[model samples]
Target: MTNSISLLAEEQVPESYGWLAGGIGAVIVIALLVFWVASLISIIRSGYSVGVKILLAMAAFAYPFLGPLIWFLFARHKEHKTRMDR
Candidate 1:
């Protein structure tokens, strides 16, 4: 009985930490929003053609997190490479 009671107490989260989790979640969400907006801006300002811009914007809007990440990791680098080749 004592062991069970101890386990239950350990499983219960302290109220003090509840707000910490929420704050961390909010920060993560805000950061993602900022990243998504920046990616969209980059796409619009890029030298890519209108069709490419539209496609990239659509991808960013569609996938939210993954799209922007992929754009930064792959498309952005590809654009830079092409520009350097010119």
Candidate 2:
């Protein structure tokens, strides 16, 4: 009974889905790389001082996904507000 159940479980899972999962994962990684690169470029081009630029770049490099997300959600808006006041 145990052998038959194990065989049935293995048969039920399709092997073809491996490629689909790999493709999806590759797309996600590429998107993250693009986003990270864009964030780095934005930081470099902003009006921030040299020290601030270094710190922001470091944060982005260290945290990868979370760092850019924080910058976009919080720091970017703050920078925009400061610019508007100027």
Candidate 3:
């Protein structure tokens, strides 16, 4: 019984800590949303077709840095070279 009580106490977050945690969470969420919107805009402006733009935007929003890196390497950069070569 004492162990269970201690566990419950440990699980209960202090109010101050809770507010701090909530603020931090809000910041993280806002940052991610900003990043997603920026990435989506970049994808849209890159002259890709609708399907590719949607795919890259989704990837950039969902997977963070890796998604943009892959898109840059495989799609954006490839198109740049093709245009330059032309």
Candidate 4:
């Protein structure tokens, strides 16, 4: 009986950790979604042409992590250039 109880207790340990991991994953996904929306808004306000804005927004929306990378690499540089010009 004691052996059976010990086995049951060991099984519960992993299950608790599984729940913790799942909760952390949920938080990460929500945070990424919020960041994506903010990036999209910044793209809109970057003063690019309508066509360029649409392209960057679509790219960022389609790929959450990669989208921001592309925006920072290309679109954001353009924004900085425009600011310097002014």
Query: What are the lDDT figures for the candidates, one per model?
Result: 0.87, 0.83, 0.73, 0.81
- TM-score of candidate 2 on Cα atoms, chains taken together: 0.75
Is candidate 1 or 2 superior in lDDT?
A: 1
**Candidate 1: tens digits of C-alpha lDDT, residues 1-86:** 99999677656857678678779999999999999999999989877778888999999999999999999888987775555334
Task: Score residue 74 of candidate 4 by CA lDDT.
Answer: 67
Clashing residue pairs in candidate 3 (N, C-alpha, C atoms within 3 angstroms): none
Clashes of 2: 0
- Residue pairs with colliding backbones in model 1 are none
Ordered from best to worst lDDT, the candidate numbers read 1, 2, 4, 3
Query: How many angstroms is residue 81 displaced in model 2 relative to the true structure, after the best TM-score fit?
Result: 4.9
Clashes of each: 0, 0, 0, 0
lDDT for residue 72 in candidate 2, whole number 0-100: 78
What is the per-residue lDDT of model 2 for residues 1-86, given as tens digits with 9 covering 90 to 100? 99999687667756777567668989999999999998999888877778888999999999999989887777876665555334
- After superposing candidate 3 on the true structure, give the runs of residues whose Cα lies further than 4 Å from its correct spot: 1-12, 61-69, 72-78, 84-86
**lDDT for model 2:** 0.83
Per-residue CA lDDT of candidate 3, range 1-86, in tens? 99999677657977568777779989998986776666667788876567777888788877987787677567776656544322
Estimate the TM-score of every prediction: 0.77, 0.75, 0.57, 0.69
Model 1 alpha-carbon miss at residue 39, Å: 0.4
